[model samples]
Target: MTAEEYQEDILDHMEHMEAETMPDVNSIDIQTEIQWFMRPYLLDFLVEAHAAFQLLPETLFLAVNLLDRYCSRRVVYKRHYQLVGCAALLIAAKYGDRKERVPTVRELKSMCCSLYDDEMFTQMEWHVLQTLNWVIGHPTVDSFLQIALSEVTYDAEVEHMAWYISEIALFHKEFVSVRPSVLARSALALARCVLSRSQARQSEWAGTYDPVVVLNLSNHLYQPSQVLSRKYASMHLSAVSTTVEEFLQRQAQIARRNITPPTPPALENQKPDADGYLTPSTPQKSHYDAVMQHGCLTPPITPDNEFGASNFAKNVLPRLYPVTPTSAPQEAPQQQPQQYSYQPYLQPRLAQ
Candidate 1:
């Protein structure tokens, strides 16, 4: 079971869940709740972009996840959403596949139909890296599978099952909806499910097949649904089963869309700086892994000057325009009236 094959199942589950669970856009609060929809929108965009461009899906998914998490923790002003989204993608591309080039602002603008300004994108790329503390190193899907393989009994069949399930789990972003930690647990849960099942022992298989952590992870992923659902009293271990159905439906939609007809636009090499807006530069790598491990808010890029601010300025600041302070028009000084010029009705004289 290669990662590719496993990704398919994961994707299937994701599609179903998204359709069933995606909150109605109309119900969302535009001012306060836009981030929730923005994350999914960005995720959807990336999924389409990866297919259209033949880029890696894992990289795109991981990047979008990181972006979502970052936004959840920090406030992204309305104007900066595109910048933040692109920055997250840039970071993901660097960390997930170091060899891949960060997409240029022009290229990304083309991808996004020129919705974002180049300087804004560049600034966001830097800001996200700063907040993340340049820590991209973390236990990825490959690492988690490696751990699972080492722990399980050494059987070729078990190894194959683990590989198959883990890869498939990647495609199902729902399994990892909470975070990397949840993702690791769900993959292990899936692997264990496959390995523990037996053809002869039907009841035993049924008992062992239920995923413990994936349900918990699913709860973490869909707290809104779990909390609000009238059907379930307290969302327990059984919720994943119910949610899994929803996930697969959404995944199917994505798959169907993937299979649909193509639209053609002549490809053009994006010339780097067409506009006078600051030239786009590659984003600096941040220590995201260290920041996550530490669990601190003031990760290198905080407003304070503790962590190097020079990098922040270079990476995160919008291009500065020279403000040549219009010399305040020189004002003429008014003369003061002499104290004795105006006499009061009853003025008192000093005695000699």
Candidate 2:
């Protein structure tokens, strides 16, 4: 979503919360109001960048979740939103991309339209790292949905439809403003509905947990009502999904309307190739040269066994379904717990 759309969505949500609960709108604003309103702005800013880069949807989704979960638990004052947003995106880049290079603080600032200075962005990044206790892994919507979908052996058509609906659901800011659990359930329901229609005659659909039940559960998360799954499915399922050909058509429309096409970073002086891979005027030195000559980087790891190959393939292949990596990097070894360090700048304010 664009920044304007995000701002309008949040304002509508605040208004709704105001009317329902009749909270004092003037005193500190809404009940959940933060003195630091910049956090949501930063989040919307990051979302626009991520969407522009054609980054993993899971990357944007998980990053936002981490930011929300962290902020919901702590208090951050002025200029802190930048820190949380950057840290969340960094964590997301790591988890979502096996070979994802760590973008420098400068690069992050550029991503945010240069709205933040390097020093301010760095401090905020540090604060987020500290707030998260420097741990990045968390259970995520992508994993959850993937796991749920894998339970049934649906056809290619079903798979395509399910993915289409899931993507469309994200564009609805009303859905995004709701609780994470509600959003998850809604995505699942949409996915299930698509799959069911594609395989209406199959016994697989019959044996699976009722799609209506899943959807009704989702609706209840938003408001109390027994929403009819068929009615919901009939109204939205076709509008949201289709076979592979139709899905691409929808993606093109989304790119034109709601999302910007993938573009090269600000540092890349030249336009990227057709596939959106950045190529500088002069190619950079290879990893081995950098490592051996300058002692700048680490060497690649060799897989030890077939079991390792199986594990890596299983973990990596499924995530590739909707988001394509810009460049393949050797998977970084998971960081050891002993080596974890939170940045000093993000340390919580000590009591006087």
For model 2, what is the error of residue 327's alpha carbon versus the real structure, in angstroms, after optimal superposition?
99
**TM-score, prediction 2:** 0.42
Runs in model 1 deviating more than 4 A are: 1-33, 53-58, 98-102, 149-182, 191-210, 216-352
Kindly list the per-residue Cα lDDT of model 1 for residues 84-134, writing each as its tens digit: 767777777767664645566687878878878788778877877776566
Q: Which parts of model 2 have CA positions greater than 4 angstroms off?
A: 1-44, 77-83, 154-186, 192-352
Candidate 2, residues 1-352: lDDT per residue as tens digits?
Answer: 6654564464355335323322122332332535433444564566555644556657866676666656655664445566667867877776776455545677777776777788876576666667666655554445444544554574444443443444333333333334333334445555545344432233432233445434543343232111212212332334332232353456568769776657766774543343343334665443222233333233333464322466577674322122444787788899867877786777688999
Count clashing residue pairs in model 1: 32
Where does candidate 2 have its weakest 10-residue lDDT segment? Answer: 223-232
Model 2 clash number: 2
For candidate 1, the TM-score is 0.41
